[model samples]
Target: MTTNSTEKRAVRTSVLRASFLYADGATRLTDKYHTSPIKIAKSFPLKDQLAVIVMDASPGLLEGDCYELDWQAREFSHAYITNQSYMKVHPSSTSEEAMGSSISQTFRLGDNAIIEHMPEPVMLYKDAKLHSTTSVHLGPGSVWMQAEVICPGRTLRNEQFQYAELRSSLSVYYGDELIFAQRQRVVPGQHQLAAPGCWGEMTHMASFCLFTDQLTSSQIGLIKQLVDDLPATGDHQVVVGISETERYGLVAVAASTAAWPLQEAMRYLWNHARNIVLRKESVYFMYS
Candidate 1:
């Protein structure tokens, strides 16, 4: 037995069942068969935006567990997936006294389809490292949605993720046409941590909402209501904003104290989007 006090990293892979599909202006997800108990991943559509629910996947993460996520949207459909809380990444010191995790996500959208996946924040521990890559392929007339946050590893633990590294890259393609590309890298000891507004005044930072469909007056009103209900946690605050984008799209921005607030913001937007889309069917209250 190794003398190291830290527990040996646990290696786990949960092949979560497929949890996505599209309906008439709505996405239907049936959890009838879940091999992994309550850790369910389901997605639905809110107008042109996607609303996904990943139940049982809480804020904290287990060591040596590589979680795999998947998604699919039908034609003219949209969905966004969110976690209940922040994603906790424990320290795993292997190979040269360093550790990290990798998240790989791929999307397939149909013509006029759209997807917005805004999960909770990933909390890093001291010396923790992470690499996340997302690929998006859109059908003709289709749009894509996304958002993410990188917090300064467990700031409350007095152990800042010193010597940490994080790399995130995203590639979006619309019908054989590459549209967007963005990449970010943050290495604590090597990069500038206090370069005046690099990460702002707070040690914990988070962002939300990648993309939204057409920004109609109805949608704006719904967003307004959602923002107004934002909660306050004394030290953390969630800020909301919207901007006009090309393709008649409206980009919604949700910046929060951490991943928790961002998730709350996404939930609000998802609910509002759902109501607006369903209202058109007379199935719910008209969002006029």
Candidate 2:
């Protein structure tokens, strides 16, 4: 009946020390959220930043849990961000705070800067409700690749997030203006996953994206092949699609999480993209 109650509310925020100039150069530095969630720092030697990572301070989130993160990149910086794993939202009970929640983030990249973000999936517990939003900005000659996964409750445990409502949105901006945005809202009780043309058939769900500079002919071929492998069935599909924005970059999005054959197919697609960039014969990092 109230936004705050006797239930103990726990929170932490911190920005880790951003390292720089060292030869070994810091690849990553965890700010330790439970210890501190806000007042963070920028990892130095950031001339070409690589990834901005945010994580829950605890092992997992419980009812009434709230997390927030924000990041920025200077001109010509580059960074790639990847989450640790699937984020689970533990259910709440009548005994105490039968509620769990989280918030969105704003990410910025300056001129000639780049950022690659891939956060683990956020799970919605049975009878849970929450909202999420993300905004990203990039400059010229910049690149980024990201992926997200969402599971239907914990399938291995025979759990279902029934009677839950979740909404998530992600937007990208460039040249001081809005460029791309997508949002997803799922309310199982009021809405239906199997009503007509919605989910109707699948259980687990996921979404993956690759945003970066122009790809070679070889790269294009690999992407096309992966799309062709999507399950012929409309309901059992991976929702594979490609887009070219900003006149100099391309993005690949694939969503799927079927049992085996489909799961393996998704893995193959991920490997294909990673291989292309890591295996470049004479590739170079511009900021260096």
Candidate 3:
């Protein structure tokens, strides 16, 4: 299939603008813009940065739907953002172009700023098609934590890897230098993702990026040990790997049949990294 086929889908674009600023020794939501099917709310308080949740008015994305999100974190500001629940991508016919839903997000960070963007898992129904893209640009001394999770299909309905297509891309950069990038395209009909040497029966996958300029050698070693000790294989376990990135950063990738293992692994790593940087336990981000 040509790229034009994917581009020809009817576009339903929704834009969200959000920014954080440092004020009165605390970070707050300085500016925000949203519309239907995309809502933002910040009621809980964190230790230093503001915490917010992105909400979807509709249950899930329909055919030919495209969503976009734009966020900026100014200098000396901090923020952590998450969603209310899992993202559901409904199925569509394979005979038509743009037979799926697409989501795009872009982040801009200033020097000495921090942002943690961790959304929930995405559940792809049987015969479902989805395309997702995320890009982050960071200034010197900035940090951004991002993660994405993908579920094969509705396991409760005995639907696994029945989707027609799934494509995704994530990229992080600092001053025009790409620090980390990941792209994947899965067509279960042509690829044996469940076969040996592949996902090997795993029904879920997750990827995370932790970009910061404040990690010591000792802390990095400790995190490496934790990643190495993660569960490798089981009914509800995940196999995880951690690697170093430019600018004192780390990236963790995991795959499993269940989502909890990956979620817990990410939580531990994120908290560990934050504790080392801030010199305090990251209880607020975990609880609130």
**TM-score against truth, every candidate:** 0.65, 0.67, 0.90
Once model 3 is optimally superposed onto the true structure by TM-score, how far is the C-alpha of residue 251 displaced, in angstroms?
A: 1.1
Q: Each candidate's lDDT (Cα)?
A: 0.56, 0.53, 0.80
Evaluate residue 259 in candidate 1 and report its C-alpha lDDT on the 0 to 100 scale: 56
Give the Å shift of residue 6 in candidate 2.
Answer: 11
Off by over 4 Å in 2: 1-55, 92-99, 161-163, 212-222, 229-271, 274-288
Give lDDT: candidate 2, residue 154. 63
lDDT by residue for model 2 over 141-182, one digit each (tens)?
455455555666765666554726678897776666666777
Per residue, candidate 1 scores C-alpha lDDT tens digits across 1-288 of 657545454556543434345576565663334334225554445554445555645344444455555566667555556666666666656445343566666777776665656566667877666767777776766545455565676656666546367777867665676656667788777866667756554455443333333446666566556667766656677666665444324456555555556655555555455456333321121111
> What is the descending lDDT order?
3, 1, 2
Worst window of 10 by summed lDDT in candidate 3: 279-288
**lDDT value for model 3:** 0.80
**What TM-score does prediction 2 earn?**
0.67
Q: Which of 2 and 3 is ahead in lDDT?
A: 3
Which has the greatest lDDT? 3
Model 3 deviation from native, Cα RMSD in Å: 3.9
RMSD of each: 6.3, 6.8, 3.9
Rate residue 138 of model 2 by lDDT.
62
Worst window of 10 by summed lDDT in candidate 2: 279-288
